[model samples]
Target chain A: AQSVTQLDSHVSVSEGTPVLLRCNYSSSYSPSLFWYVQHPNKGLQLLLKYTSAATLVKGINGFEAEFKKSETSFHLTKPSAHMSDAAEYFCVVILSGSARQLTFGSGTQLTVLP
Target chain B: GAGVSQSPRYKVAKRGQDVALRCDPISGHVSLFWYQQALGQGPEFLTYFQNEAQLDKSGLPSDRFFAERPEGSVSTLKIQRTQQEDSAVYLCASSNRDRGDHQPQHFGDGTRLSIL
Candidate 1:
């Protein structure tokens, strides 16, 4: 079984400032990690994933996350935040040989202030 | 050409009424997933299917919740004996069964079930 924890329920950032959303996971084996963003009343959008290929993964909309195995963390970051970036972000994890079933974190709502 | 889609974006059902939510995966997607999201919470895995075979249903709340992906393309989630506790957003996602690669999943807008 796999589980994920999002450190913050909400994060506030200023436009053009750096943004960070923290996430942690617990898995028995090598875990597949992902980030997704959801707009209000809209579907989820896959931001990026880390699948043991690279320690650092880059995603769309100028977002990226770094996987730290020792820390059991996959924190989402972006150098500059935009107004459109205000949305709900989720951190997900899938265990090995789990048929791709995912465990999602509680999600972090980002508020981009102008 | 289209992404994953879910029908009946919003549903209002009586406490005892039943409801069905639909999901259409992307073109040629073989793996589909269902999840339940409560208010202000993350999505919890409900079930998973690979080409019409339900391989994992560990997260389903009860027997009243049933899902099927007949013919391996379109899927439906049927909830019987709905209750106030069952009011939440149901999400569907699909991914390609790619080997040795990070196969990203595409998600649908989700069906919001409101039981009154």
Candidate 2:
């Protein structure tokens, strides 16, 4: 079975400052990874994805993530944070050779301060 | 794009009542998925469909949970004898990939089901 672990339950950052949300995964086969953001009472929106196509993946809303196979980690990053960035984020993994079910991390709540 | 759409934004059911949830994926998207998310928790996979074929249902909690994509487009998830523990947001997603992708899943706003 595959699983994902989010390093933090919450992360607070100041607007115009850098931001990071950490995630790690365990899978028997090469995994496909994704980051999603959920605003309060809203549906989740895709942030970015890594499918072995690129190590550095860029996403919407000025967000990006690096798929580090050696570290078994995929962390989301932004050069600068915006107050609207405050929301919940999820790190997910899909094993290459399974039923293609997504294994998701518990989640990280991001708080952007003005 | 219209993304994905789920019906009955909110649902309330008494214990033991049967309930049905619906999903409409993006036009021409052959792969569809269903997930269940508890409050403050990541969504858990419930099932997957490719066109009219039900490819995977391993994640569905029990046999009481059944999902089908009748015409390879709109889908419905029926849960028999709903329980309080069944209360959660049911999310539906779709992707362009036929067998499914490791790519991000496009999600619906979700059906918030409450059991009282």
Candidate 3:
């Protein structure tokens, strides 16, 4: 079974400051990792995906994540935080054999202060 | 529609009542999925469908929960004898199977079910 753990349940950052949300995964085989964001009363929006192509994956809204195989981590990062970045972020994994279902982390709520 | 569309954005039902949620995936999408998101938690997989075939349903919580994609374009999730524990946001997503598994699934706004 594959699973993901989000290190922080909540993260707060001031505007123009760097933001980091940690995530770790346990999988038997190579995993497809993704980051998704959801605002209140809205749908989950894909931020970025890492499919073994590049270790450093860039996503929309100036977000990016680095897939570190040795560290067993896929941490999301942003150079600067904006007020609109306040939302719930999730780390998801797809196992090698079963690509149908997505295993999601508990989630990390980001709060951006002005 | 332009994206995945779910009906009855908000539903309030008494306990023991039966409720059904609908999902219309993007046209030509070969894969559809259902997930349950409880308050303060990430969404959990409930079921999956490939075209019109119901391939995997290992995530269904109970026998009372059922989902079907009769024609492959639209899907429905029905819950019988609803319990308070079943109250959550039901999300529907679809992806192009031919595009490979790495493709991100597009999600709907979700149907919030409140059981009383």
Candidate 4:
């Protein structure tokens, strides 16, 4: 029953401003977490992943996330927002054990205004 | 062939009609997966395949939904007697590692299915 909760359903930011999309996960054990972005009519793209190697994980396109065990959070952050960053973001967790299934949160739609 | 490729970018079918969606995973990838994404929602796992053997299909919604990957390469998801509820984007993904590995799954532009 591992799952992720996206705190915001929609987040709007002006261009060049910082971006934050909150995600909290529920897992019985140490989990594998990932952030994916989907553009209009495009496939889901992997932005980054956390596999316990490091608490702070960096992803493509100047994006990064921190895996905070104490807070049960894996929030995605970026120093600045770009118009191209407008899309739907999903926080995902890999099912524990051999199932390897992915449990996704109810996604957050990011709108970057220029 | 650079990434996972799905056929029929869009599909429109009448209620009770049957539709088949295809997925071609990355070459040499040992694992393949199928997912269903409703409008304004995240993608949900529908099934998994390990080299043509369907190891986990627990996420499939019902018996009317079926998937196959013969020879461990291209996979297909078939929906019989499609209902309006079944209208959604069917996504296909592939990974180049074994089960339990942390290798990220690469996704294909999903096939959007609409049932009237």
- Compare the candidates by DockQ and give the number of the best one: 4
Highest lDDT scorer:
4
Candidate 4 pairs with clashing backbones: none
Docking class of 4: high
Runs off by more than 4 Å, candidate 2 = none
lDDT of 2 by residue, A1-114 (tens): 778999999999999999999999887766888999999878889899888889999999999999888999999999999999999999988855435767789999999988
lDDT of 1 by residue, B1-116 (tens): 48888999999999989999999999888889899999998888898888899888988999999999879889999999999999999999898883213687789999999999
Tens-place lDDT per residue, model 1, A4-114, is: 999999999999999999999998877889999999988889999998989999999999999999999999999999999999999988755556677789999999999
lDDT of 4 by residue, B1-116 (tens): 89999999999999999999999999999999899999999999999999989999999999999999988999999999999999999999999986948889999999999999
List-wise, what DockQ does each model earn?
Answer: 0.69, 0.71, 0.70, 0.82
For candidate 2, write residues B2-115 as lDDT tens digits. 879999899999999999999999998888999999998999989889899988888899888999998999999999999999999999999888867665578999999999
Model 4 Cα displacement at B98 (Å)? 1.8
Candidate 1 residue A8 C-alpha distance from true site, Å: 0.8
User: lDDT by residue for model 4 over A81-101, one digit each (tens)?
Assistant: 999999999999999745597
Instruction: Say what the RMSD of model 3 is.
Output: 1.1
RMSD of every candidate to native, in Å, equals: 1.6, 1.4, 1.1, 0.8
Tens digits of lDDT, candidate 3, B42-86? 999998888888888989999999999999899999999999999
